[model samples]
Target: MICIHLGSATAKNLIEIAGAQTTVCLRIALAGLLAMLIWRPSLRIDPRAVPGIVALGAAIAGMNLCFYAAIEHIPLGMAVTIEFLGPLCVALLTSWRPSNLILAATAGVGVLLLTDSAGTASWTGIGFALLSGLGWAGYIVFGKAVARHTATNDALALALGLGTLVTVPVLLTRAEDLPLDPWFLIGAVAVAVLTSLVPHAIELNALRRMEVSTFGVMMSMGPAVAALAGLLLLGETLRPVQWLGIAAVVGASAGATLLADRHTPAAPETPGEHQPIRPTPSEAVPVP
Candidate 1:
């Protein structure tokens, strides 16, 4: 949670100069490089998995682009609170209980409070955030699809690389805006590490030791964490109502995840290999 917020704060600090496109391109590009170097995934992957990889890569690429663009137009906390609807939707879709509908309604009210559309919030930004949420949902679906065909790390590395490729045209247009100063370049690299490389490494390790359901529930705290990051790191304060809205979303996420877990059966552990669960895009953001 902390690392995810830190990465978000770091990107917000850079977006003024780098712009959303450049920031996302560099971050994912660097992440792809790091993953390739570390995993050295087979260059000759099975052909059957290409479509899943492409879809997952597109999801990651689209998610980051929309999400960064969203924060560019809206407050960090509000944007994240809205973007979290993706995973929340996934959690709800997994179960058909009446409680899930209540949870969904709670999240909707929370979003309404956060948007307060009649006031200063930009509907355009909200739209982008919603699109990002959709991208996030696609990410989880395609990630699982790809995992069914290949090793997790290899698929992820390839996805990162392919995502970077998908963003290349946009990156080209913004390439001239990329910082040339040594310190600024360093800051960009640091953001990449903080946002992508570090989180990927840590999440990969953590998944080996934790259950997916537990991780999902913990991830439900993302909105609160992002709100704190906005307050502390970005010096952006939320109104009391906004805070309540955030709480509602977080509570809904945790509740939905727990309920889904209770209703679903756990997969048996593999006999010998210590296989980690495939990560959702949200889950990829390291907690600390």
Candidate 2:
């Protein structure tokens, strides 16, 4: 999930140039446009899939907006660490294996250590991050349902479009100050592609291949990835404890994924067809 982390890093840069709400709105709009252009999904959608698509769209909008807001008041690593709780919760609830529970506790400890290293954090940021985490959990749940009931690309594209629509009122308030210079536009587009389009594209495909619990456990690496990106791109430094925290998360994720693989039940393949019982390592995260 380097792409997701990279998206987080680039989002920091974009938020500096524009307000959090505006940046998020623009990013989703551009990504939606790109998805629609490429996929050209039919206008009509199955009635059964409507609620899932709408919830998925709303969750994406909420997640991005809350995440951007959280980062405004806290360090990227800290925000991501807190926001990760949503997916970690998902992993635990979906799979109640002793190993998964242990790993979730391990991740919790790592998050506590990571946050401690960030010094005094704003409670507002913490709240926002928690809400973002909730949104993320919803995104995964509804996303899985959407992917199951509809064409993957079409569902995602439509959801993004709906997200953009939901954010329009907020975007309008800042329209007068929105950057329009050629150079700024170029950067905005780049940010939109990296932060919105790429990760969603990779993840939409990945969700179809792996179980949601497996996906969440793998995505638990996002904070570590964010920490590394912060160091390289933003010149942020991690403390010894924070380093240990990253290690804890990484180790737990690896162990859980491998454990899940060994115990995963095989499903029968269709006639004349063969599908891998478990997803590959790279397929687990879908980084490009």
lDDT per residue for candidate 1 within 128-160, as digits (tens), equals 988988997787666656655566677778888
- Local accuracy by lDDT, each model: 0.70, 0.77
Query: 98-144 in candidate 2: lDDT tens per residue?
Result: 77778877887787778775457799999999999999999889987
TM-score of each: 0.81, 0.88
Off by over 4 Å in 1: 44-47, 97-104, 198-219, 256-265, 269-287
Q: What is the alpha-carbon lDDT of model 2 when measured against the actual structure?
A: 0.77
Model 2: residues with Cα > 4 Å off, grouped in runs: 265-288
- Give per-candidate clash totals: 1, 0
RMSD from true fold, candidate 1: 4.5
